[model samples]
Target: MDNKKVIIAGAGHGGLVAAAHLSANGFDVTVIERFAQGTLGYDWTDMFEKDCFDFCGIELPKNANYVKVPESVFVSPNKKTKIKTEVLSPITNVNMDRSAIYDSLIGFALEKGVKFEYETKIISPIVENNRVTGIFVEKNGKKETRKADLIIDAAGAFSPVRSLLPSNLMIENEFDNTQVFETFRAFYERDMTVTPPDTDWNVYFFHLDKPGISWYECREEYCDVLIGRFNKFGEQDIKQVIDDFKNEHPELTDKIIRGGQFAFIPVRRAVGKMVADGYAAVGDSAAMTVALIGSGIANSMIAGKMLADVVIENNGKTDVKTLWKYNVRYFKEINADICSLDKLREMLCTLGTDNLNFLLNKGVVKGEDITAAIKEGGIKLGIKDLIEKATKGISDIPLLLKVMKTLNEGEKLSKIALSIPEEYDENKVKMWLSEYNC
Candidate 1:
């Protein structure tokens, strides 16, 4: 048996990815999962499949749920624009069955000699000398202590390891209520055999003329369609909204036989720097969901890969100070541009449907324009200029200016937020945290 052991909490994609890498690196790895199997099965895009497959040297599953969506179409009440080309995004611009991807990772880890403890829940981190040595786990009505050279907290949003660490570990966090999203989605089998429109792998993003409410539609295999309504809306209202949308878009309704409904609540915060004291948190445990977009699959996989590298480089030895490099790489390399996108989302939230209509009427902001602007530089300064210029010769110019100023303040705050990297020195991190306003 390998003396160097790594214990991973959670059997999700992130945890499984980490386990696979560690096991391949000659570490005796054990994965603990709360759910037995088939728990987290969502028909969404699985960005890590290709990379994970390559890493594990295996073939991927081809199922209806695992169908790929090639491009995204941005739609408003009456407008629609499609992105023609496909980019190699970490989280692919594609969609798949999220659960199948999870299951695949688990199988890969198991084949790589990683042990699994299904129906197991991790209570807390077992710490000695302030270094995470292992975990206190409960399984099948039995409690036991398992020790490992390193512990990876791949647990979801609410991490068990966070409470054990200092609160200042994530002082630069700036997530607002608006960032959180409540969504209802359902998979429906189409009534007709005729192929659905935009059937060649297209995702529709409806910017609901309202603030905080947006929806997406994508075609799946076997005449199925994935309809998702995301934002701050009640379940009943969401169902009604979907119904109304179906009615409004007869072309969509024609192909659909019936629709089912479900809801998903997502976190909208920048990935927190919580890798400390011989412990590391990845996936939603680190609040790594994309702010405006709400994509986390790829981010979680990336974190898993990164954490594995950091652990390998350190040769199983880790501490608060030494683990800081992992956090640095997370924000700097993988998550830097995503944080900027979050700031843009905040700015857009302020510009609700009315502002969009106004921009459309004035011929100032178009979908193409916005896309080109973001691709050219970023949505920050370019949007501010457009908003300022559009409000010219109107009494609301002052109001626009005020809003722009506030929006600029938000941008500045975001800049400060992005600048707060995972610092190694406790004193330096504390000083920066104290200086940060949000």
Candidate 2:
């Protein structure tokens, strides 16, 4: 059989991984990226599981610069109580510069014969007879269509290609504000004259009594600060948060080192439908991030490998039936836990500042609990643990009930996530999707 031609819409981490694998497996792969080659990723660093490279069959970059993230201190809204949580595991995660990650991934894909078309903007998917046959693209004052046997959408959360798909395909075309995290991230020069805080990493829940989270990480030369909200926030909102950070941390300087940009991330469970007749969505395009924190580098790469495996197994077929196996495998193996975390995230958002403060101050939520929820992607409390929390929070019966309800709902969501149909029957899949979304 002739090699299948694959077109990846974006240079996302997962897309690059899939491109490499598919190319190596005798598929003609091309990646179209809006940004230039050297400027593929964000300016700052991100933390993800260290095993992602190995899982994607790519070698770690020799010159990679990274460090183990320090323990994080979760501060209450009122700042009266703080819970310090240790790193999930000594060797489980690493903080690496985003540019370096892209360099490694792009290099690996290049070595595998994957072609790249930089400075190309993907306009939309070209659908013919309910099958995506190509993409309309604009490049250097030219507009044309690039045909391919398969189109892998590795575009970020707000992908025009995915959002503009034909409505009859049943793929979710948009993510509402509640399902997206609007984030502002920046790095400022550290003031050498001022003494740094005792904790190098601080995560403030409900910062300034707002319905979002803010974090400040103190490094040697700079401090990384981020403010994220479930809904859209404007420049004034970002300024207000930064001003608060400046007042609290004297070590933060006025000089901006790098990164003062706003980005959107998917902070919900993977979309109910991620495939169509001739297309597949991976990475942010598929909402693969951890709902609580918007961390997707690891998950995206792993899912990319899974996607490549399914495609290769099916003899390069890109039909919905052939690609549905990837969706089933991903939901069963990875997204089930993420679905549960999405529920927990909803619970956190519902808990107002006062309730969160009470939980923290009263020791109803502990550092270990936070660590476990993050590491495992959801809360995993035993009977003894639950009873202890219930007793401690007995004074606030309503809060206790809310917590219990969230846990119960999260469990049910996980079961539903895992119950995705093993075979792709249109009716069965549609019915399963209705329950999964509910």
Candidate 3:
């Protein structure tokens, strides 16, 4: 690997983490970044599982920002009922400032001898024999080709390179905007002058109810206001929502540090095929974000490292057969529950307000159930809890029937995900792909 060159298409968390791992493994790695040196990611606070600190190998620099917002309470549209989960274990759900994390990861990767090309745009991949050999990049005023033994696409969810690849090489699909969670969030001045929303962090559900949700967080410096919708809100104006909140707390919204950031995050499960002969995808580009809650910082780091390890373990071969193990390990070890939860997300999102009211307000779906669902791995329900849920289901037969029917179908997906083949058998892999909607 020391003699081999690797090109990562994005300098986001996934690319930076992969660069560090590969550099540590003695590979010559270079990151192609679209943004300039400093202005890379959006202004937002994200929470990752604490295990990422140990497993992802990212060091938290002194003065690193840690957000203190607690778990949010979900208020019903009618406002008659509110649902709150106890503070998730700090050990599992850890809040982090995204900007600080980017700085630390970039600094550490640079120190590890990974090269970065700032203000570079990836034009296209240079494919040879159906294999991604390198990329054509545009920097300054000219376009130049950078060749590498392998190309890793960490270029986020809307990755163009992934789109341009020949259909036969991989599953070529466009990121439909309908599947995106279009979020416009702001960090406003938090004025102690006006009383803020209770729970510090809370969501107002059923805001026109169309497969979307909104929430807010109060930080030391600002009140974070986030409003988002699914498919593309036809006439819904999130800006107006922010304005309403601002009117309520002008003292806090008056002085804005970072006004807002609009980001479209992928809310899908992992991609079916993550590799061609000489290419692999990680992070958002790979659709690695967790389902429903839309968290991927930790998953990307783990995916990046696992991809690098698979490449190394295959004697530095970047062929499809060798790289396929990256998908194996990711689905089996790192994101197995994510696959299951993808089904779960579909089910829960399909349920109308009525179903949720019964589940959340009536305690059919206990707060502990949510705590378990949002945990890093995913939900784990014991036999006792199952019986309890069954007993409770008798009170609401129709809603319970819907839930059970959905759960029964979803379990099939879980079983398929759990039984991923150890070795890549083209036929078996093809079958898995069909089940995974390849």
Candidate 4:
């Protein structure tokens, strides 16, 4: 049989991994990216699981520049209380520059004979009879069509290809403010003259009593600062937050070192439908980030490998039914945890500063609990643990009740996520989607 041709719509981390794996498995793979070569990733660093490279079967980049990410200090909105989390032994997380990660994945794909079309813009998917068959693209000021046996959308959260798909496909085409995190990240020169805080990393919850998070990490030469909100915010809001940080911490200097830009991240569970006839989505296009942290690198890469496995197992069949296996495997192995965590994230957004301060001040929510929830990607407090927390926070019965309600709701969501239809029956999948999303 002739080799199946795969077109990766974006050079997304997971899509690159999938391209490599598919190429290695005797499929022809091509990646089309809007950014030129050597400028494929963001101009900043990100944190992800350290073991993802091994899991994706990609070698770590030579002289990989990274540092073990220390456990973060969660500061109450009032900034009077800080809860330091316990550090995990064996160092589960690492902060690596985004460019280095892209270099590694791109190199791996190249070695596997995957072709790349740099500086190519993907306009939309080419559909016929409700099945995607190729993509419409523009390169060097010229528009053209690229045909492929299958298309993998590794595009970012706002991929036009995903947005423009035919409505009958059942795939979600848009993300509301509640499902997205608007973020501004910057790295500023550190003022050595000023004394740095004792903690290397501090995350401020509901910064300035706003429904958002802001954090600053003190590095040797620079301070990495990120301000994020669930609702839409503008430059003025960003400036206000930066000014607040500068006033609070003299170590954060005015000189910008790098990464002064705004971006959006999907902070919800994976999309209800991620596959259609002859097409599938991975990475941010699938909303595959950890809702609490907006970290998708590890999960996206893992999903890439899972997708490749499914495609190879099915002998390169790209129909919706054949592609549904990838959805089932991903939901069972990964999304259940994300779905559970999203509930907690939603609660944090609405949980006022007073209640949050109370939880921290009263030790109802401890550092270890925070660490566990992040490490495990979900909240899993047992009845005994809940009872202990309730007793400790007996004064705030209403807040405790709210926490309990969130936990219960999270459990229900997880069950629904795990119960994704094993096979692609249109009506059954539609019903499941309604229940799961509701």
lDDT winner: 2
**1 against 3, candidate with superior lDDT:** 3
Order of all candidates by TM-score, from best down to worst? Answer: 2, 4, 3, 1
Tens digits of per-residue lDDT, candidate 3, 1-438, equal: 557899999886777887888888888999998888888777777777757756877665568676664866766655456678664555566777778888888887888899998898998888888888889889887989999888899998878678788887655457665456887777777777766655356676654454666777766667777766665642247655656556544545644577476788887677788888879999888888877667788888888888888887777888888888888889888566765566666766677777766666766655565655555444555446556776864477677666665555555665677777777777887777787662
Task: Please give each candidate's TM-score.
Answer: 0.77, 0.95, 0.89, 0.94
Candidate 4: residue 329 lDDT (0-100):
96
The candidate that wins on TM-score is: 2
- Provide C-alpha RMSD values for all models, in order: 4.7, 1.8, 3.0, 2.0
lDDT per model vs. reference? 0.58, 0.87, 0.73, 0.86
Which digits, one per residue and each the tens of the lDDT, describe model 4 over residues 239-329?
Answer: 7887888887888877788999889889889998999998999999999998867889999999999999899998888899999999999
Residue 432, model 2: lDDT of 90
lDDT of 4 at 121: 95
1-438, model 1: which lDDT tens digit per residue? 255888888865667788888898889899887777666555544433255455445456666254454454444433434443233343634345666677677777878889987788787777676667788888887888888877777776555654455444552233345655555555444435544455433333343454554444435433334443334556566555556555533334423343343544344544445566657777777667665556677667777887777777877666766677877777666554554455556556666665544444444444554453233213444555756565664445654564455445545544555676555777766654554434
Winner by lDDT between candidate 3 and candidate 2: 2
Tens digits of per-residue lDDT, candidate 2, 1-438, equal 288899999999899999999999999999999988798788998888889999988887777778657778999999998898874454888888999999999999999999999999999999999999999999988998999999999998998789999877878998887788789899989888988865358889889887778999878778899988877778788778777888888888767789988898888899988999889999999999988778899999999999999999988888999899999999999899887678977888778899999888888778877876766656666557667877754578778778777877888998999999998999999899889888
Give the C-alpha lDDT of model 1. 0.58
RMSD of 3: 3.0
lDDT of candidate model 4 versus the reference = 0.86
